[model samples]
Target: MAEETKVATGYDTKVEGEIKTDAWTTDGEIVEIIAQDPVTAESEYTEMEYRRLRWKIDLWLLPLMWFCYGTQQADKTSVSVQAVFGISQDTHLVGQQFSWLTTIFYLSYLVSEAPANYLMQKFNMGRFLGICMLFWGVVVLCIGFAKNWATLMALRALQGMFECTISPAFLMITGSWYTSREHTLRSIIWGTSNAGMSVITGLINYAVGQHAERHPGGLAPWKGISFFLGGLTIFLAVLAFCILGTPRDVRWLSDREKRMAVARTMANQTGSDRYKRSEWKWNQVITAFKDPQTYFFFFTTVANSIPNGGVTTFGNLVYESFGFTSLETLLKGTVPQNAVSIIWFLFVGIVTLKKPNLRFTFMVVSLLPAFTGMLALALLPKSGLLWARWGLYLMTVTGNLPGLMIWTMLPSNVAGRTKKSVTATVLFIAYCTGNACGAQVFQAKDAPRYIPGLIACAILFGVEAAMMVLWRAYYLIQNKRRAKKIAELGMSEEESRRQGLLNAEDDMTDFENIHFVYKV
Candidate 1:
């Protein structure tokens, strides 16, 4: 008992509870098992020193994530880009086959989320993710070689399975390094890679399309686009393997620095900078299911992503139906529309940083423009006014905002390794379902207008907005209940603080830890 008390007290002086013996570790290299509370030692380092450390971490980590995320988005959207460039004609795709190509990718992606997250937990995240990237790149490269619709479907399924790890893995890494408050901006920076890559890849594909138009007998422009993107993805994968690492594995920090890094983020209440925990607690998973908020998130993901599926898979094609040439679709349509999305991402990031609790507000705010856009697209006559219809289509990019908040909230709000993992999987399953369904809505028969699809998207966005409001209320009520329990316990502030810190160290889920407050 005396030894247990000593070890427990030794770990964090501010924490006044007994830590489980199993949680104690002699592996000081990965996670320092120091005698004093790290927060005190962290105070000795100057603020500038901490700033410099953050700068270094940002410099090293953000760019790699940004590039990797961008590449993944580029690869996914390449199908849409290639569609405008005659991939359908060349492959003799007809009816729903083209739509199925998009649908199958997300179908496979949905199936793979849980297992991929499990593998990430069991292995070195950087290496595991790197291997997934490398294989997916090869799969993407082989897509260019596909001769028919069946071959394309086969390769797209493979791509979906491999690409499943990117978002969840990136979210885990983001949470591992930064505090909840800091995660928003950094996430936007990397998350906006989707928009960034859209613009960059748009330019590249446009140039390539022009070249293919010049040399029709040589390699098809769509094939060249695939090969080039695949090669770039492989290069980025090698970089991820070489340079990308978890906070625990990062070579830049010393033993003391690693401890301080972990200590600095203690205020997050959400755990960060710890070695991987391989044991999967079934109880935590159960707790996640029992939590009402889990279902709300799942619903929101499905609702928001239904539109996302429509836009991402067919945005370029929709613009083509507006009477623009394929190259004009790439340049005038895809690039500018994505640029608008970039602005939305940056706008939300800035506002959220200045006003932290406004996440739900921004989520609702994001849907309105999309709702209006979809209404216009569905109701307005296509021949009424060309530029006006195009303007309305551009407004649909606002749909992406709610989805971004959903991603941000996963790391910010959820606690416990197993619960977090389970929640992410459920959320992504909804995401996949929504995307898969979204792709099928704009059937080939509905071409030019696709009124049915637009109407569906508009209604879903409103439902999603309502769900977001309800979810926010749920969080607010839950936090109040937790606060009442804390008061009823009659624990002193210091004791409560200590217990909270200990709970965080134990990797307790929000439900398991009574003092854990949900960030609204």
Candidate 2:
């Protein structure tokens, strides 16, 4: 006897999607799902609707990630505050060596970034990064125990090696979990977390410095700050272990939700389920290096990081010049971050909608304000108006300019997981390039008037803007060529739709043999 078909609950083809087939749904109903075989129990995977993601997955996940990476960024940069409260006196720290303590992290990070990302491809991402988090937390705690410059520098290097993977790891996780619409907002949330860290750094400095003065025979407040933060980071790392960083790894998701999620991503990457369980390959690594988008993001980050280096490392000094007391200077410095972070984030989202292709334009335009502000500082004689410097501080939010497009653009064009990982790794290397050079600019003697350094940053940012323009044009041309090729082939409309512009097959064709194309 033919049994009555079971209706699949919560498996609306509009939302969960189906394979286009007359097959038994999860509840055993025979329907034309978007799956491959009409008679089998296969899933009909389709793209995820960006307008329909539940808040639990996208919203909650973003904040937790923001907190994790923000803490890391802020705590690592807090050494500037330590340098202020006589940490140099305590350790007899000096030039270059003092600089190395901060800069060496970038070296370790660059060295570790590619391999760490490679590992994420092979291992369970949450546990892998969570373990790295715990290791770095220990190193940060050990910073409190440093008795000399040598010890502090060593720990910073170790900290860098461990943290190398944190940002890229989070980005990779976010890319894997969220749809294209959610990625921009999530990236901003993650970027904004760094702003949160800046705010905390100022507060921590005040709190720790107070402890050192009032409490006797205890660890210095900065030391206490380092240890406390390290402890906090470890606790958060534990929380990370509980969450599946990748959607594919999440057991909590039902087969219905899993199919919906998988369908959305696979549609973007390739047109089938071939990649559902594929492992790493050597060609995947080489493919990432070959991508042009990888290099565009790289140049943009390098440009952006130079400014980040100067502003972040020497923001304290900029405040000090305005003649505030030590704590007051930090307090004042913290004030700008509150405004700049909000501005950077909201500006990116709001402006992107108006001019989707205008990201690079805005990035280049953003540098002008700070550059002009520096000119104002240099040319305008020092008067009672420290207002210009305060404005200059606000203007440095130019660091966010290229960033608006960096992560978003990668996912927009690339679909393969390996390619995304490779793009992120290369992008961060550019980020580290800027950070490494920027760290060197805050030389001890250059304080109060780091004019030379600021001027150099302005020049580099200009160079980045130029590169961005060229890169944007280059991609546009590549896209047009691909489009023309598709039309010249005289393929049917459906065939053209299926194969895209260049007929480039996404790396995962083993599961379902089909031709695909890169979209312009």
Candidate 3:
């Protein structure tokens, strides 16, 4: 271990724990990277040189991230458009049976989410994800040609398995590129994509209703919608292949821009660059399972997703029950609630900008609408169709709420590559579980009213809220214990400094030596 006189970085290195070169030094040897420049000086760089952003873009990092993810949301959820077509009628799908299609999809999704996130570091995620989009597009296209119920179910399962990486990969990439605070804003922006799904629902319905029923031939409208959406996915996937660049080896930009990008990346992420050097490790999973915080994250993801179950899978179905034609239901049904969600998301994004310390408070606000929406639908006794549509609009958007915190907790708290992989995998498994459970939440037996599922969702909100609060408390407890242990040692600054430099393989041992606190 080397001691060093502190100096800031000159350029971004895209390196995590270890530095490629020292930019500045005063008196001390490089004992531990007390204050890294977060940059890798170029081969020709002088001691005075620093990284610079040669190319400039008008959009800030957060907004760009928001748009990318928003597009992602719209792209993936397009299947909702197929609900009004003759496809379901031909397949003979009922409420419970319909739920299986969704249930099985998330089951596959659960199996894949963690591995996808873990692999993000291993593979060039942009290319891999784009390729996944291509795969899903082909699968969705194939779905349009499916003949029987069994055929549709199989296709849906395949679609979910492929799409699992889309979001987690986005999260992993976002985590790599942004800081905790910036991450939240982008989260909401991308979160607003949930609203975008509804925004397009009307236009999609108009197109499908007018033409799908009787196109050039007797082809079903839903099939047309599926084919069209699948085509769009393919187009985007191709663009991604050409445009998307790997964070570890982003060669699209100039050397200066690359350095700036890396430095900015390192500073924002506080060193996620290490994972780029390696693939997923099983040890990380074991550590993640033991971490109490991971459980809390899981609870929140599942809780929020339970309410989300109604929207992603059965949103159009719920609207159809409101005594409106499919076209009218989609048009009138989706707009108002999406408007509310859009406003709330932007508001929350701004309000919570200053409170990075209280991330859960924003999540709580997002859940509030979902809880109320479900309650209103369950309790109110109108045509039931009338209130149910509005309730669904509100409930559908609730999923975006916890999503912000879910991402915030991962990179902000967990550090090891292995731990990160495990945390992501287990959390996503819980995510799939929540989604799978949600697929089963809506029952045709409850029909028009569906009070049982509504109440189940509402009760779930309470449990979720409590779990989030408890998760925060657990971290506080862990932090306290760690502090007490440090005090008990009563080591001098010099001794403490001495112990900090060992580059041992055990992260648990490293955790204690570095005085790493559990972030809430």
Candidate 4:
């Protein structure tokens, strides 16, 4: 006689008497079941097959993300590029007005973070992000037509509000498809667009600058660059709507393939990309606030981004101040500097891929170059040794590394949907605040060499490095405490790992999942 059993909603069940396992339903209560011929498990993809599937997903997904990220960066950084090409002159921007352009953009970004992420979590990721991209693209194109600083700032503010969704949404999409071990490399591949777009846009602006110079009366080069980038952004937005989606929503993947995709990331111990609950959990939000890691990540974001804001928004100007022509600034200075950033991102990505546990270490390591760069920029005489100063300026690209690492941690380390959403919003709010504040430090009185800004950046880098060490230590302690609790339960290593995977399937938050181990 066959034996019967009952299982809860989450656990596997067996059927007897030729009853198909597919017909079994728990419906949030215990369900009666019996032993029968074992059904073939759905998650039976071989290691090689899994690798191939991952590659296919990467090929399908990453290029679109890369393009989206590149366009977003290009659109945002266009203001800085346009400043060099004569937007400042065209709009009659004077004194602190140029700085206000950056400040207002981030201010709007900060304000939009919570609502934007809420929508990202609540809606289809691809559609929502595409819509944002479309709106921001329109706003960017309108920027080309702005007649005064007030109009320029208004357009920039709107652009910031729309563009705020891209980074957090992409981070979630990346985490959903790839395991923690795979996230760094994938992230770097896309994140390097921060630099990649800079190079491409720099070249475009250089050509446009030359055109404006030659024509002398037609469309300003700044306006021309804006129109071109805006149009490209709209084109990519359409592609994003069609191509980009979460793992579960992609058309190319079969149902079985989607299951395998989620299964492969079980080691991350975070919940599925799909929402398990429609309502927000107040407890998770409270937990996130009380969590020390949250604040460490928050502080790290603020400290690191001050320098990034200073550099990204004003890099071309800084290069121009160093006695280079606007064309040389774009082609010679910004392009090569961003190329160095690409190298840094690629190097860190490769290193982390080979040894996933060393993410925090590498984050700290990447900062050394940035600190050195900022210090050199601060102390070096601005009047002479031009190439040396330029080299130091290039080193500041290391600031990009920490932000990338922080994003990787978000999806890997946080679990609950509400917690993750709230955390992302808080972190980005810190980012916007830092950038806004960073923009102000370089006042009009500072002019060519913003000595105060460079010095502040140097100090912030040192503080950020110290904070990274503290963040790592906090994770280590929490991991140790969790490990001890698991030991106290008398669970074997394999059993604990199994339980962790089970918890992942159940959509448990990091705090509720005792078996979960953070990837440091």
Off by more than 4 A, model 4:
1-43, 274-276
Better of 2 and 4 by TM-score: 4
Which candidate, 1 or 2, would have the higher TM-score against the true structure?
Answer: 1
lDDT of 2 by residue, 1-520 (tens): 2333222111111122333332223335433323442222223432244335445576547767877888887667868677667667778777666667767878788888889988887777888888998999999888888889878878888898899878877776766675455556567767777776667656776888777788767777768778778998898788776674666555455555555554455434332222333466666567666667667778778887877766666767667776666777667666575557667776776666554556556666776776666555655555456766666766666555466456666655665556667777888788777788888876778767667777787777677778877877876776566556545656565554343311122343211112233222
> Local distance difference test, per candidate?
0.82, 0.64, 0.61, 0.81
Give me candidate 1's TM-score against the actual structure.
0.94
In model 3, which runs have C-alpha deviations exceeding 4 angstroms?
Answer: 1-79, 212-218, 265-270, 382-399, 480-514, 517-519
Ranking by TM-score: 1, 4, 2, 3
Ten residues in sequence with the least summed lDDT for candidate 4: 33-42
The global Cα lDDT (0 to 1) of model 2 is 0.64
Worst 10 residues of 3 by lDDT: 6-15
Q: What TM-score should be assigned to candidate 4? A: 0.92
Question: How close is every model to the real structure, measured as TM-score?
Answer: 0.94, 0.83, 0.81, 0.92
- lDDT of each residue in 425-472, candidate 1, tens digit only: 998999999999999888889997788988999999999999999999
List ranges where model 2 is wrong by over 4 Å: 1-52, 216-218, 270-278, 350-356, 382-384, 492-494, 500-520
Q: Over 4 Å off in model 1, which ranges?
A: 1-33, 38-44, 492-494
Model 2 scores a TM of 0.83
